[model samples]
Target: MKKTRIVILGAGYGGLMTVTRLQKQLNSDEAEIVIINKNEYHYETTWLHEASAGTLHHDRVRYDVTKVLNRNKVQFIQGEVLEVKAKENKVVLKDQEVSFDYLVIALGANAETFGIKGLDKYGYAITNVNAARRIREHIEYQFATYHTEEEKKDGRLTIVVAGAGFTGIEFLGELTNRIPELCKDYDIDQSKVRIVCVEASPAILPQFDRELVDYAVSLLESRGVEFHVGTAVQEAREDCVFIGKRGETPKELKANTLIWSAGVRGNAVIDNSGFENMRGRVKVNLDLRMPAFNNIFVIGDCSMIINEETNRPYPPTAQIAMQQGEVCARNIAKLIQGKTNLENFVFDDKGTVCSLGEDDAIGIVYGKKIKGTAASVMKKVVDDRALFMIGGTSLLLKKGKFNFF
Candidate 1:
């Protein structure tokens, strides 16, 4: 009898975790496991903001896939996924096709532009390693050319960030911290540079407690970050952004750099694969498997599950993604062993830490509120913990944030 072939897509948090666990659980003769990703290295999605702001090197956020996966048990294929022929049990890649007996879709997310005019053509998003690197380079180039350029355009130093959510706020925090260094390096006046955050919602950091939200806003304000709340960015142009307030005419703000961190949906491949999804996310069963297919599982940002207590979908995060991956691996192992019982995924609510640059942060962990240096320390601990979980102590030592004082 042929061995069961298991194919996992993408090397994000969920995909990498699943592959690592499965390799240890299943013997080489039991099943053949393969992981397909567009890039050979897996990047820490949560740390992309640091890369975008140039505060952290891009190399620090990424890891080689071969280093983590056991070559003897798992095969890693570096290729772009074009589409999934679900009905045929085949995945279409740019250059080839692969058939699988069991498939796991964890391709992750893409920025949702929300039909905003000119955004697709001009706006930059902190989506992946390459995109983050580009944003960092673009900002640096503008600063470097500020004096050399014949005309001094104040707009070149203005950065407009759309959305005030977690990703947006984190990025703004990094930018605020990096601006002073950049100004000194480029010999630009700090007063001339501006970092503005525009949010359509009535408030920013809606996910956090009201008190924490206020604290975050005040912290950002002290760092010279400006907030334009309850306003929507109607359009983005090459040299400026058009924003509108409630019952007001749209106004243009000149800015050479526009970063859109508003919202994210699942990868487009999920929709193109013909699976039933809401915003490209499949509402998976309790076991993390798609409703229509037993052999197919979905995790990370590409999968959605309603929270029983709140009656709302849980916000996709690296915390939940890693948990889901562990559950998926155990359940897959059960099926291979002819066991009937499958494990249900239960997310352990540890806490959330929102960093305000490298030194300050706010968080609610294990039901206790923390801020200032304490929260900042907790934030670094969280980062290191994630690295430790995925790649062990050695990997943590190499990529972990150790200075938590």
Candidate 2:
């Protein structure tokens, strides 16, 4: 009998974990495992904010895929996945095609601009390693050029961040921490630099409890970060952003940099592959497989499963993505081994930590509320834990943020 071919698309948390677990659980002769990703390295999606702020080096956020996957057990293909022909059991790539007995889609997410005007043309998003690096560089350029120009454009020194969600808040946290350093390096007065966060919601960090949210807002404000609550960005231009309150006149804020951290949708491939999806995420079955196709599995941001308690979909986080990968690998292995029983995905709520820069955070972990230094310490532990899970302690030591003081 021919060995089953198992192909996983993306080297993200979900895809990488699935490939790693399957390689260990199944006998080499039982199946041919393959992982396809656009990049040769896997990045810590959670750490992109730090990268964008230049607080952490971009190299620290990425790990070579080959370093973690066993060459003898898993085959690695570096290519962009164009589409999935699920009915034919094939995946099309720019350079080649592959057939699979079991296919996993974990291709991740892209920024959702919500049809906002000029957002696509002017706003920056902290989506990937390269994009983060570009934003960092752009910010630095603006600061450096401010001194060379005969007429000073204060807009060059102002930074406007749209959305008060996790990505936005985390990035603002880092930006607030980095501003002093930037001011010193660029010979600009610290007071002259302005950082503003505009949110459509009434409050920031909506995931946290109201008390913690208030604390976070106060902390950020104390650091000279401005919050424009209950405001929406109407448009983004090369040198300014237009925002206003509901039913109020729009006002323009001049800022060379506009970072949009509002929303994210699944990779476009899900829809392109003809799978029914809401914002490119398929409402996966209990077993993590797509309802439309038995052989196809969707994980990470591309798959949506509802929270039983709230009747709302759980926010797609790295924790859930990694867990889904483990369950996905187990089911695929069982199918290959002729096991009739398949495991359903059950997300364990370990808790969540929203870091407020290097030494501050807020979280609720293991049914206990944590904030300030304790929460920040827990956040570092969580970061290190993720590294340990995917690439072991050795990888953690090389890339982990161990400074939890």
Candidate 3:
């Protein structure tokens, strides 16, 4: 009898979790497992903000995929994903093709510009490892150039961040701390450098409680970060951005560097693959499979799970992705073992912690609100826990953030 073949696309949090769990549970005779990713290494998507701000080295965020995956049961393929031919049950890669009996699409997301003009060409998004590295180098270059130029453009020292969501706020937290160090190195006055966060909403971190949001905003402000709470970025230009409230005339804010952390949509392959989706994300079934195709599972940012309480979509986070991966893996294994019933994916609301640089943070954990050093400590714990989840003790000890105040 031929063995069951399971292929997972994109070794992100979801895909890696599924691969990790399935390999340990399934025997050699039952099935064959293969995971395809564009890169050989899997990086922590959460730690990207720190790397982008030059506060954390890019090397710390990623590790070789082989280090965690079992080679005997799981075959690792490194190739770019072109598209998934859902009707044919095959994946088209840049250089090859793969057929699957069971498929998991965990291809992750792309930065969404929301129809803002010039954003594509002028702004930077902290999307991946290479993108984060480019941002760190780009900011460093701007500071160094400003120091050497006889005539310095004020815009060279100005950074306009388009959103104050989780990514934007965390980046600002690191950037605020990094600026002083950069100023000392570049011989530039700290007063001359400006870090501005513009949000269309009335408050920063709209999802967080007002108390937490206020504390974060106040703390960032104390560090000389400016907030345009109700301002929207009308357009992005090479040298500046036009910003204004709903009915007001947009004013140009001269800024050479613009980072857009406003939003992200699912991977482009989801659309190209002809999945029934909105903005590249499939509204996955309770079993975490695409309703239109029973054999295919979609997880992580590429899949959408709606919140019944709020009548809205749950925000895609690493926590939820990991949960989905584990559930999806169990279901796949059950089906392989000739079982009929499959488990549903459920997201347990643990809490949320947003870091303010390395030493400070805000969180709501298990119904208790925390801030300052306490929250910061929790943030590191959460990060370490994630490492422990996928790669076990060795990975945690190897890449865990141990520092706490």
lDDT of 2 by residue, 250-294 (tens): 899989899999899999898789889998889999899999888
Stretches of candidate 3 exceeding 4 Å from the true structure: 150-152, 403-405
- Please give, for residues 1-405, the per-residue lDDT of candidate 3 as tens digits: 888899999888999999999999999788999999999999999999999999999999999988889899999999999899988989999999999999999999999889998999989999999999999998998899996764537689999988999999999999999999999999999999998899998878877899998999999999999999899999988888999999999999989899999889999999888888988899999999999999999999999999989989999899899999999999999999999799998789899999999899999998889999999999999999998999999999899999332
lDDT of 1 by residue, 1-405 (tens): 899999999999999889989999999999999999999999999999999999999999998988888999999999999898988899999999999988999999999999999999889999999999999998998899988874537578999999999999999889999999999999988998888999999979887889998999999998888999999999998889999897899998988899999989999999888889988899999999999988999999999999999999998899999999899999998898889799999989899998988888889999998988999889999988888888887788888879423
- lDDT, candidates in the order shown: 0.92, 0.92, 0.93
- Candidate 1: where is the Cα deviation over 4 Å? 150-152, 403-405
| Per-residue error (Å), model 1, residue 265 | 0.3
Q: After superposition, which runs of candidate 2 have C-alpha atoms over 4 Å from their true positions? A: 150-152, 403-405
Sliding window of 10 residues with minimal summed lDDT for model 1: 146-155
